[model samples]
Target: MTIHAVIFDFGGVLFDWSPHHLYRKLISDDHERQWFLDNICTQAWNTEQDAGRSLAEGTRSLIEQHPQHEHLIQAYYDRWHEMLPGPLSDGVAILEALHQADVPLFGLTNWSAETFPYARANYPFLRCFRDIVVSGELKLIKPDAAIYHASLRQVRAHLPDIQPEEVVFIDDVAGNIEAAMALGWQGIHHVSAQRTAARLRELGVGF
Candidate 1:
């Protein structure tokens, strides 16, 4: 099957998202800030929220384990928007270019449904995707075969002729790219916008 569409990841790819953005202000010491995120507010723990738990529940549960950092834990949800500085215009430009070329665009992201609204509300470009299967809403994250398959199934529903090999997946994480490739989709490991645009053209799938 010929490539028919491009799928993108939300954070790190289309937008600038980082906990350090929020923690930088809360913890002035760079090392201590890393320590806080590493030990106290770890990505593994946060993945639970991305797996569909509500912000209130995730925050309350963490506070129960580390009461001393309750204030900081709450701050994670309170100042969540601060973590997302803004969208990546370069990536947005690629998305627009593809959209203009009539290439179907889709999104598969590991974002908390609870916090996803902030992004959806702020990034109008997200409307470019024909569909976005959020991890929080699906309780499934990237590198998981289920989420990738779900995205394919959703796409197939709309474009019946589309096949697994007919999709090009763009993502920042190596693991996500590997997962998509394993499913037979062309994978672009997004390092920089310049490199990504070049890769797309090299694959003959560019706008």
Candidate 2:
């Protein structure tokens, strides 16, 4: 079937989102860094936070776990913008090109509800998408089939006749691309804007 829609993953695909940036800014001591990773980084608290849990509630829960690191938690939350960079203008240009071609565009991102607006504000091209499915809003995360299905549902709501194979999903994470492919969607593991543009052109998607 001919490709009709294109889905893009927000974080690593368009913007450079680095957890190490947050860790470096928040944890100076090596011991504290290890502790933070053990108690906070990969914990269920973070999972819940990414799954629509309120920031204040997540912060409070973290503080309760490590009273001594309350200030650290506050600082990290206060300056969350430091973890993200501007969108790749080249990628946005390609997306805009696709948009002009009447190829429906959507964003599938695993972002916290509390921080999504901030990221969106920083990246104006985010508004160009026809639909956006944020994991946090649905209390789901990527690599989970539910989230993929949810994204499909959102697209289906608008273009009800669209088929899964008719959509192309682009992401920097191989795991996410794999997940999308599992759902019978075409998946592109984005390396660079130039490569992506070339791939899109090869797919007969006009620049």
Candidate 3:
């Protein structure tokens, strides 16, 4: 199928998405850090949050279950801005090139509703896309078929003839890429700008 659209993951693919920055800033102890990541940063808790659990409710649940680590809850809430440094200039250039080529661009991201506006302000390139599907807003996160379906639906509503195979979804996480591929969308595990550009070129998406 001729690729007609490109879906980009915001965090790692387009921006410097580092979870450890907040993790290190919050949890000082090494052992406690590992434990917190294992328990809280796994797919389950994130999936629950994406499934409409309020941030306060989710944080409260974690605090209640892991009372020993309750102090870290507020820190997690406070440090969201630390995740995004700035837009990856090279990646943004590629996205702009795609847009110039008249290819539809969309975003499928696992971002919290609370932090999305701040990110949008910081990265103007985010607004360039035709469609933006955020997990927190939809109450459905990535790797979940529902969210992917929702993203596709949103884009299709705008451009009725677009097909799933014609959409290229890029994410830094392997699991997200796998999930998109499973849904019959072209998926790219973003490593570097060179690789991303190469992939797009191979797909006949001119830079």
Best by TM-score: 1
Worst 10 residues of 2 by lDDT: 38-47
Regions of candidate 3 where Cα sits further than 4 Å from its true position: 28-32, 40-43
lDDT of 1 at 157: 77
lDDT of the candidates, in the order given:
0.90, 0.82, 0.81
Count clashing residue pairs in model 3.
1
How much does each candidate deviate from the true structure in C-alpha RMSD?
1.1, 2.5, 2.2
TM-score of 1: 0.97
Q: Residue 54 CA error for candidate 3 (Å)?
A: 1.1
Against the true structure, what is each candidate's TM-score? 0.97, 0.86, 0.87
Candidate 1 deviant stretches above 4 angstroms: none
**What's the C-alpha lDDT at position 178 in model 3?**
96
* Colliding residue pairs in candidate 2: none
| lDDT accuracy of residue 160 in candidate 3 | 94
lDDT of 3 by residue, 101-177 (tens): 77789998887787678888877787679989989898888788999999999899888998889888888889999
lDDT winner between candidates 1 and 2: 1
